[model samples]
Target: MYKTSTKIHLYTVRSQMRPALLLSMTLFSLLMLSSCKKGSPGSVNDPGTEPQPVADAAFLQVSTSELNTMAIDNKNVLWFAGDNRGAVSGLGNKNKNVSFVRVADQVKSVSVSDSRSMIIKSDNSVWTSGDNGFGELGIGNAVSNGNFVKVADEAEQIEAGWENGFIIKPDHSLWASGFNHYQIFNSSYSLADVVDTYQKIADNVQAISVGQAHVLMLKTDGSLWVCGQNVNGQLGTGNNTEQRGFVKIMDGVKAIEACSYHSLIIKTDNSLWATGHNEYGELGIGNNTDQNRFVKVMDNVSALAGGRFFSMAIKNDGTLWASGYNNQTFGITGPDQNKFIKVADNVTAVAASEYHSMMIKSDKTLWATGSNTYGEIGAGSERSLSVFTKVKLK
Candidate 1:
């Protein structure tokens, strides 16, 4: 009887071992399955699943009524802007208007630097042209020379206001000319005066941005100075009175932008402040009331752009935010409310025109929103959209 009982105990132990072995095998299978499902990072079994190649850095291609601008910062890529009436790409030397020369033929956009002189920075060195009506071209009123003529000494930076122009000298001084309806061009209180004012404050100007009727400057002291049309309180002076000269509006400004009727400034803290027309809630103040003083809109802002009647911004995390007039006429979606709304994710930089908006992602992909009446959005379609749509530029 003792032998039989021992045998029974051994049988029971064997039974338990079988189940344990099976359980171990099951766990191993699951681990293998998980590994197969996830695969290796950045590897794809199907070629179709691979991500499309994009440029290494962010850039933009913009077009105005009479000109186009292709702004690129990536060292490995070349930027090109085609003319509204021309087409040339990859055909060697055909009769196409797609070459870099198109940028020189028409004076679409111009940028100057105090150290570089006046560089059209477009396609060729052909950097100055257009109305020159106000000598805004800085080429001394040579009207018959309808084409862009190079200026001898380049400027540190150039700013084009509604009807005026300003240049920053190497000495950190400011020089300006053209229309100054509200003393914006008063020789006594012009660019030279601005440089003097900045000197008195122990601040050096680094950059300048001009709005339709206002001027904004960034001082080395991290403060923002504003002047010009204040009829709609776009000056952010805490009042609606027009400022004949530059006045300190806020401090710690890291970047600034100006629109046709509004202004925006981003502080070092990644916060945004906007003043001016709120007719479409462009100020993002939660209401349509005009803001004469700077008001906080959101945080973590990395980049921003303004349009004639709307605005857009990007956060550090690559999320895109837009507000104001999002109508078909403007190339975007709804203005839902007086607040910023996320439109897309993974955006790197944003650019805005009077009626369209464009963005470049870290992967070098481009996306657009708003109006496309003139192929400004580059979709070849003339529909207005609220959400972002990818742009195929190959």
Candidate 2:
């Protein structure tokens, strides 16, 4: 999680930058346990306890990163932040497990970041919470708000950026607010200021994935666009130039995932392509060299995710594959950093962070691995999990 202060804390455990990134691709992150045991929260124990309630097909959505890990349960509700008012946001007690709270009816989904969270109900009315220092919440002012506030009412999806928010309206138009890094919001580039209110940027947008310093937008026509910092060519524009305006990166792209300084896209052919920082070979292209243009990574990918310096993908066979930054998060060793390694089977979805990972299995149960410092992994037990463990969700 980003410190409310101006400094960023590094989680050496995973050897990567910890942004409120990942667990945030067209799904959510920045979510909280909507309900907890009525009394003091207890340690989330593992195994041989109560059987996990079956996850609903409609509520398979899950995301996690930085201090808060959350999901939309079969009942259409889960965790939340700021309830503890601690550095990472949560039930506040780092030692306590999570809980769920029923959301108002018609609540479609929620997205979160380091300090703020945004919810889009069925009515498309947007509500926000957390730090508004830069007005990322679009609450009409820069006042830092800890409680959820009604910000915008539209239709469609939303994503929380490193310190901003990306919104897709009912008309398929794109809108955004907060830190304007490299003008990803489609205006003058300025890292020193922010757009306090949501502003429209484009039209015919299908989906968006905001990374730590860059963003990827997928158009309704299957073309991909990018903007922002590219010191490592994350934009895949054939150069490392900072893009102040959205530029076409590729086409026939059916899905996209972005993280700190890298990106991955799935072509209509089901082949995977990648670009950006590869210091840890997170691109899964068999090398550590960064690419200024999208390079083929593999074929037969159904879904993908990007983390600090690593990536995860689900194959057509329901197997989970991972690569880069050799950490326990991927269930592989340092020697496997440059290549994709099968991590798990019968996996349906996965979410990652700089030091942890979360997965939803075929059984609809939640499982996690890697660091649990902020209980981001929330596997019930607070110890660092080198192997994926079934999480006991109340």
Candidate 3:
């Protein structure tokens, strides 16, 4: 048996700059117990004694939108910040030189879109905040909200896209609302009539990823399905055709990610594969040619993420590798990276948006790079950064 004990502390820091930039921070202290290793039944210590839980590791995980960032610490406290123009509320500010402030409380997880945010609280209820243009907030109407509003109950996971919101129920079923552009909801509903409430799509879903106009989901049996726009073959259906409903594209998939016009998958064998727009070699296939079918990129990938025109992966050794547009958008200088290039080591988790990227180290410290327009990079300045910089937290 496995168990977890966690402690969460909220940290809010505001930039010294006028009209302060908000940064949300969560300090997670976790205690975890590993499952018992294989051993002879009568060779181990007395069965009467319970195994003690271990404090081996803890780290942060982050997700980003076009304008905001959200993070879940080891204790499941979700912290949020960015685009304060009525984009998100429940924020606490600090008068300091820091560039981040903590917001929200008792959150278990979070996800963001271009202008909206969603979080699952400890009670298993889901809440939404920010832009609802097209009903992305999943609040049962096409109304925008600046403050967090309860949208659903008994949610297990949540995600937001360009203007769409998605939630997974306790039954491993998928649900969504918001913009119907490219038929993201797998319905013939016109763009003029967007989904207002969380509508059911499919069941037995193990994971779901939302892109600008496309969406991907993984079934409990390791099957991959995709729907929506395929202008650049982002659906990986071996063709450039739009899909209104879920279509099986691959199997044995362990993880998946999507953004803008591309899709990525990590198989059970720890191999990385990609499909869709490669205008800037975001596929990391050693060329800028687009692919309609999934193509192998590398192996030994442990975790993966994709930006608008770039993708990032972490190896089993804790090293970070990236490919695709290498311009300022990639947080690197010089020519574009057609093949995976080692950028950093000891990275535990990563989150990528259209123009900026944020990562967490094994030590639980956060780092960011790429476009800093509006200080979304959490570097305390509007100037873009081409190299990773540690975000100072209070």
Q: lDDT: which candidate is best?
A: 3
Candidates in order, TM-scores: namely 0.67, 0.79, 0.80
lDDT string, candidate 1, 90-127, tens digits: 11222212222222322223432111112334332324
Give candidate 1 regions above 4 Å deviation: 1-69, 73-126, 144-147, 152-156, 169-171, 186-203, 328-332, 381-387
Per-model root-mean-square deviation over C-alphas: 18.0, 16.8, 16.4
Clashing pairs in 3: 12-102, 13-100, 13-101, 23-100, 23-101
> In terms of TM-score, which candidate is stronger, 1 or 3?
3
Off by over 4 Å in 2: 1-59, 80-106, 142-145, 186-192, 332-335
Q: Once model 3 is optimally superposed onto the true structure by TM-score, how far is the C-alpha of residue 218 displaced, in angstroms?
A: 1.0
Q: How are the candidates ranked when ordered by lDDT, highest leading?
A: 3, 2, 1
Once fitted onto the true fold, the runs of candidate 3 whose alpha carbons sit more than 4 angstroms away are 1-59, 89-98, 142-145, 184-192, 329-332
Winner on lDDT between 2 and 3 is 3
Q: Write down the lDDT that model 2 would get.
A: 0.72
TM-score order, best first, reads: 3, 2, 1
User: Candidate 2 lDDT, tens digit per residue, 161-193?
Assistant: 887888898899998888777766554546577
